[model samples]
Target: MIREITEQAWSACALRLAVDEAALRAVAEVESSGSGFLPPPSQQPKVRFEGHVFHRLTGGRFDTTAPRLSYARWDRSKYAGSSLGEWQRLEAAVALDRDAALKSASWGAFQLMGFNHAMCGFPDVERFVQAHMAGGDAQLAAFASFVDRAVFLDPLRRHDWASFARAYNGPGYAANQYDRKLAHSYARHHVPGSGTKGTIV
Candidate 1:
């Protein structure tokens, strides 16, 4: 996907996120197990397939019928009721409204949303995803902002894992899960330049 979107950009993004070769490799492992940039389509779930699971897992405000299955079938009217400044849109399921979110949300790589793209100054969701795929400084900046603002500096910057998870996935109840993922990432590999020589905190 990175090669298909932007060949030159991915290198730079990888460097920004990985301070060294080992760290970079570890990040790759976490991202896709050193496989192709785009995960297999089979890995993607249809809409609502996991909606109830999400609801039960987080008790979030997501509707069980929020229409998630296919990206190639979005309709316009369905876009109206979503939250203001939605993170991303389903290009196929939505009618392509100017105010509708970008298609990046459906892609779900990096777990990024359309709102994050706009906040980071990308013209649209495609641009944001392309930046990530291409591995440019812009994507790194955006990812860093998300981590610093929404993930690490929110109301739970100190130790509220729940709050951190909510920041990652909105008002959901899966903060603990996200925290565990982050912890695993940090433990299995260093957080880039989080430490020098022998320190990793």
Candidate 2:
């Protein structure tokens, strides 16, 4: 999947975020294994896990305080909702009809949510999904916005490859999975999201 998209579409949007072909290829594989319908790992707080049970039990700060209330009845009730993994959600979302697709959720190639998608500059859910589905450069640009903000700006911009990868994929994610992936593609690749040190894009 990554090969198909990057070989065709990576260049189109990669320039916008100054990401490397190698890095984009690595990220695409890490993110979805190149499958457009796979879900992202669940990064939402546990409060969202229990859903309404969490809301009623904890008075709405469930994400932050749920661990403390593990003994509550509501905690047991938290199982009411289905725990959808990242891949399941992605498959369901992409297979939906147009109206259902737009309203379902905003996760795309990288599992970016509604506000994140909009903030990253996609006009709407359709645009976000379409971009990922289009593959190649279009998907590259959409996913790049996520990389730029989360990984590039904060730590990567400072020439901290390890830190940048950690920030992008959660702590240790970059080191364990992402870095090695890129190494196979380009030997001289610099860490992305940092200041100008090499030819960008």
Best by TM-score: 2
Residue-level lDDT of model 1, residues 66-136, one tens digit each, is 44412233334444343222223343324423223333343232345544566655776667656655532
What is each predicted model's overall lDDT from 0 to 1? 0.39, 0.44
Cα displacement (angstroms), candidate 2, residue 182, comes to: 5.2
Model 1 lDDT, residue 128, Cα: 64
Q: Write the per-residue lDDT of candidate 2 for residues 83-185, one digit (tens) a residue.
A: 3542343343334333332333434345444334565568765666556555444555666666667446544334354665666655756536665554443
Which 10-residue window in model 2 sums to the lowest lDDT?
44-53
Using lDDT as the measure, the top candidate is: 2
The predictions' CA RMSDs to the true structure, in order, are 10.0, 9.4
